[model samples]
Target: MAPPAGYVNVRRDVTDQFYRYRMPILLTKIEGKGNGIKTVIPNMADVSRALNRPSSYPTKFFGCELGAQATFNDDTERYIVNGAHEANRLRDLLDSFIDKFVLCASCKNPETELIITKDEFIIRDCKACGQRSNVDMRHKLTTFIVKNPPKSKKAGKGRKAVAGADSIAGQPGGGKVEGEDDESDDELTKKIEAGAAQVMSEEQAQALIAQREKEDDWSIDTSKEAVAARVQSLDSKLQNSLVLEDDDEEGGGPYETFGEWVKEQREGEGVTDADIYKKAEEMGIAKKHKSLVVLVQAIFTEKIVEEIAGHVPLFGKMTTSEKHQKSLLGGIERFVGEIHPDLIPSIPKILMAFYQADILEEEVLTQWGTHVSKKYVAKDVSKKVRKASEPFIKWLAEADSDEESDDE
Candidate 1:
């Protein structure tokens, strides 16, 4: 059967696959008192899921293009742009977003993922053609994308190895083995000495030696005696180069020391969750700020998922800003997505608890819910987290509708 007139196939070109992938047409309803009026996208979540994007991306795009503020209230599933807009106009504007953010540049297919590089450039990775096209950074959406990159397709080590091989094959004298010819020690020593002359410093020589050792691993003798002798020789050279440290500390720097301190704190009995956050601040974890999210992940275990309601105050104290909120969300993603995927069913309950405690606002949750980042977790884990949270997300949206009708 044909999809409703208000709905369209995500891959518009694939008319035959209508039933396979369909999304409702953009819908808008303007509501509020004077000066507070806003257009609400009632089905924004459904539309976003169909396009495989965060609902906030398109909602934000609408606001940016129209020069207005946008708000996505997860509690109510109310996607609001701070102005009156026609449903048809939004539907048309959505096509522009799909063209820029959704469609693959090469195949024009909608099967694409959003990738944000470390340098803050956005890339549209097409699943169909396997082409990665850089998105124009001039758009306002780029900043949001950097903060909330979509889940990427898992490219295992095999793909990376194949790519590395391809690059190597493209280089000069690419595939041929180096130093294959039998050369006498005297001649090889002369060549090594000549190469060493090009080495500018002791650091460079150390690096070179490390590289040579790595390359020689397979060819080197693995017999127990030979291995032991090689290890002893290397250990002797390393000891000669080593600088002694004070007895007060071990070999590592401040970060490692801080990590050890945190571990010690975690091991202490009768310690509360609040005590952990307080200790983190005292140890300047709060000052680092960047490390707070990582600490959140490490601090919370799978056991917390079963009792998230009690930990609300801890999360509330920890998330002092948006970055902290993002980090906390990232931590949750890792804990549930990777470590204990079986606890996926508990996500909605945890989120509601966070919401009720005022630890996370609706806007924050809505924005966080849309993204699947590998920043705090593994790629596969991020994917699993998102998959597991879908039902809870849908329920959250409908729960909003139910509350609205009751108010009416």
Candidate 2:
């Protein structure tokens, strides 16, 4: 059976007739044209309210998935996404977003609250199942959610009235009536007397302290030299313990060692990409996928767009298969998204650099551009990186289309 005229079941996969969670169906309008094209969701606020999330969340999710810029105006209650998108396409994406961010992982219940922990982790606390689950911190939206946490609902009028009544009853004689039993007054008097009785006299307190002092041994030496020796011994033990723990926690893996070496080399004078490759070869992880990721992350700086071309030979040798290509992309994502977000807007140029160098193949770039994943970075950062690469991806698609047209 079709859903009610304007609202649909929040969990579309659940076809139960009485499933209570329902949200207004999404409505979208395509506005503007060409470079300025955008899709506007006028009812975004209502839909988000029903989902118990901010309107900007779904709006931004659409942008991330579509590689478009999403913006929301709180005053106007308008959510807009760059580029023309159909309602059905957006609705499908919204379902995907809901599955990842909204529903309870254990019970699939929609009655869940997004909680941000002190350590900056996102948790979905479910009211229905009484379970708390962590949200995937890799998603780009987690950053947004952490910054703009859900607004707690204010106390209702009924609650306020009850609180007012309690305040009045708390005052002296506020709740008393003529000839009332006054059981509460009697209980309060007994509590006060019991508390008074538990207090000891000054003589009894002095006796207790004297007894404790007599019971405890105080035979240790009090000489200044003895105290200094004890302090020195404790400091030595603490320093040794900390050194052992630090050594135990240190990473001795090949990738970690290689990353450290690269960082050291980068900080020093005249360290070329070839030198980095040579170091990776010496460590016997030159062709490893993860090594590629580490190399990209460790070697690059803010001048990645300008510097990437010169390192083509090194990347060309390391990036052998699709896996290596993906690792390379992952490394770039971490470098740009986490380490140097100021270079986010330069993502397209970076991709083009890799493409022209033949370091990253068209197939891998296309697949990477279409999907947003948290394998490398937070989902939102991945989306932002991809959105910035939309121009290049679109060009690649159009070029392929032109080639097909020529064949015909």
Candidate 3:
């Protein structure tokens, strides 16, 4: 993003600024709404422009920015912190900035050494060409105030090129990112689709489309109602001879299928169960479960799949048998039933483990890992991991299949 036109550009030489800075920046370790990066490194020319412009910019050091000196090496910060370990390092009294920092508006100095006073920068002190050039400090805003500057929005990082299928420039049909896939063009596209932007001849597009339509996974072989009824029928049949625990832990009536649960989620809002399942699969809830699609689907309603994702590790650990799975799900139904549907997306992974291991059976997991999953090979997860977990991996593949209908 560019700095807004009206804003002052108190910078140093842009050419010298081109050298990558190695100094660890304040708050750079933290990842929040913004990526852990601050300040646009300017070329020497821009730095010169910043140094020359002082009217709109301040000339005092406001000790708010982190020390960002031009370093000889280019390195990205790599410290990872979570929970309480990630603390606010700098004083909140003043604003702070990182690499390629703009000179302090109050001090007009380029290096980091600003002292805070009252509610604003009171004096100026230069660190490089060391100079304590202080004059007035009544009304001035620090460089930190310029964050997310209006002009900077469009001036940030340029985009990396996407595949021909995903990129707009090269494909015949605007349907997929091109060439980077491992599978044949037909097979790779079966997963997600690009919007209509293919550049191929009409003959080629028709050919590709026709080829894609033949894939069982991507084809709209079943209607929404058809799929739901199929799942419902399967559920009833699967549990037909299964015995129910006489008393529910939280004592409730019969549990609803994911379909009914989703409909009740937004009360008449029309959140199709298919859409819920599709989105969950695309976002990878399904991929994470693989062969356990039916089991996972039983637990995740579209409204709360995100929440389920947080608990995924736990769910993954707990679920191995049909009976134990339902018991754990009963717990979720108990807890989530009283909460807002929207919050279903926010459940943490830790909770998943907590709830799941509590009432889950260890043997079911052992059996699935050593038995049930052994029957089939996982077709997807193989790409990211070794083939050893193939069987356990296939369960998530079933979920993966539901998300492939669209061109995305």
Tell me the whole-model lDDT of each prediction, alpha carbons only: 0.56, 0.65, 0.30
Task: Compose the digit string of candidate 1's lDDT tens values, residues 1-408.
Answer: 667767786655566833455667778888764555668898998788677677888888887677565667656777888668888788878988888887777777765566543323456655457666656555656555554455432232111001011111112333321221234323423433343322124565576566445432223243557644544543342222121223524332332333333434455543455355545555455444345434544455567655555555455445667777665666566556655677777777666555544455666777667777666566777767777667666655654554455348
Which pairs of residues collide in candidate 1? none
Off by over 4 Å in 2: 1-3, 152-408
What TM-score quantifies how close candidate 2 is to the native fold?
A: 0.44
Model 2 agreement with the true structure over 178-237: per-residue lDDT tens digits:
211356334423522332121233564465456445333312343557644544544342
Write down the TM-score of every candidate: 0.39, 0.44, 0.20
Off by over 4 Å in 3: 1-18, 21-24, 27-233, 237-331, 334-408
Cand. 1 Cα-lDDT? 0.56
| TM-score of predicted structure 3 | 0.20
Return whichever of 2 and 3 wins on TM-score: 2
Q: Indicate the residue-level lDDT of 375 in model 2.
A: 75
Predicted model with the maximum TM-score: 2
